[model samples]
Target: MSEVKKIATRDSYGNALVELAEKYDDLVVLDADLAAATKTGVLKKAYPDLHIDCGIAECNMMVVAAGMSTCGFVPFASTFAMFAAGRAFEQVRNSIGYPHMNVKIGATHAGISVGEDGASHQCNEDIALMRTIPGMVILNPADDVEAKAAVHAAYKHDGPVYLRFGRLAVPVINDHADYKFEIGKAVTLREGTDVTLIATGLPVSNTLEAAEMLAAEGISAEVINMHTIKPIDKDAILASAKKTKKIITIEEHSVLGGLGGAVSEVVAETNAASVHRIGIEDVFGESGPAVELLKKYGLDAEGIYKKVKSFI
Candidate 1:
């Protein structure tokens, strides 16, 4: 069998910036001394003048990006999730989100998948934090294709955007020609009636595998890749809830105020179905290999399959 191709979404973020820069001259990338880690170094290498290294100050980087946005330049502030969303929460909320600036926050190494970085670096609550802002658009792409598309969409958007990327190299699932990516739309990967598996970010591929496992056991599972957490695809969620009646939300972030929470809010409003959230329970992550951490935390394919089987 051929080996599956894998690429980190952070790499995609950097490559996307380089690609977009060729077309949009006003595109600027700022990094908090993490250009290499966040993959923004690719942009610096290609277009030296367009990239800025803002030292280790994440808060100041956000403020600078906001200021640049006011000058008609689309600025993407790149940094680790912990610093961008956690350390610089005040600046992100007040300077960028409050004013609704067209600054794209490229937050890489999000969630427990940040691996050996341990609890302090793993930012599992970034989605929750970004969602609280009034006009902040959150995009957690599942694979390389989705991530690249999301970066382009973020540049076109005229408001604040939080683009969450991971350090782990995930499988390239959406590599087909007809694959489409929109800001506030959900992509249905598989259709079934037994249950619906709504997933975001790195857990999306695992959720698809779980659906296959459920099918082997004579259970039909619908799979939906929810790339956009904020301004979620409510109509799609409602339709799936109405059809399956049982929904399971999977994500790499925390269960509270993340993708699971967002889906639950919509379902609860209409009382469409029951939602079982699968993600990092309210706790800190431990240092380990990224793959092992995912397996131990029940975010892998086998883990997701076992959880869905028990839920059924």
Candidate 2:
């Protein structure tokens, strides 16, 4: 049997820009001197004229992208999630988000998966921060296929968008030809009647594996991949909640204001079902190997399986 393919979504973000640049001449990429790390250097190497290195000033890069948007150019500002969403919060909120510019924020290295970079660089709060901005679209792709598709969707979108990417090379689960990526829509990967496991970003493939473990013990689990967080698929969440009666949200972010919070809100509004959130437990991360951090935080497959089993 062939080994499962793995790729960092950050690489997908860069490759997607190169592909889109071939089609849209007005598409510009702005990087904060960290193009190599964020993978925007792929576009820089391919199309020098289309990529700009704005030094280390993340806030300035955002304003530049906002300005470029007014000139009818779709600008994708690339940087680490810590700087893009945290350091440039003011610029992102006022310059890009408040004015609703046609700018895409390619925030790579999100969450504790950033590994040796430690907690300071690992941004677990980006999703929550971006979610607060009105009219801001958020997409946290699960794999290479979904990440590439999300970049295309962000380019087509007319307003501010936050695209979250991870440093970890995760399994490419959505590689099938029949798979489709639509903004604001959730994809159900497995169907079960016991409980629903809704996951986003890097934790998605792990959640699927956990579901398989649950199946072995007669705990039928439904798995749903929620790529879009801001404009979440309410209908899908409602349907799964009503069917399963128990819901568990998994993400590589904080349990607050992220995917778990979003799912809980939907279930709460309609009282669809009970929700158990699995993510960073509202604490800071420490420096460690990416895989070890995930294990310690209980975000890996075996960890998720144990948590789900206990929850059941």
**Model 1, residue 199: C-alpha shift (Å):** 0.4
Per-residue lDDT of candidate 2, residues 1-312 (tens digit)? 999999999999999999999899999999999989999999999999999999999999999999999998999999999999999999999999998899999999999999998989989999999999999999999999999999999999889999999999999999898999999999999999999999999999999999999999999999999999989999999999999999999999999999999999999899989999999998999999999999999999999999998888
Global local distance difference test of model 1: 0.96
| lDDT, model 1, position 129 | 93
Worst 10 residues of 2 by lDDT: 173-182
Q: What is the lDDT of residue 109 in candidate 1?
A: 97
How do the predictions measure up, each by TM-score? 0.99, 0.99
Superposed model 1: Cα runs more than 4 Å off: none
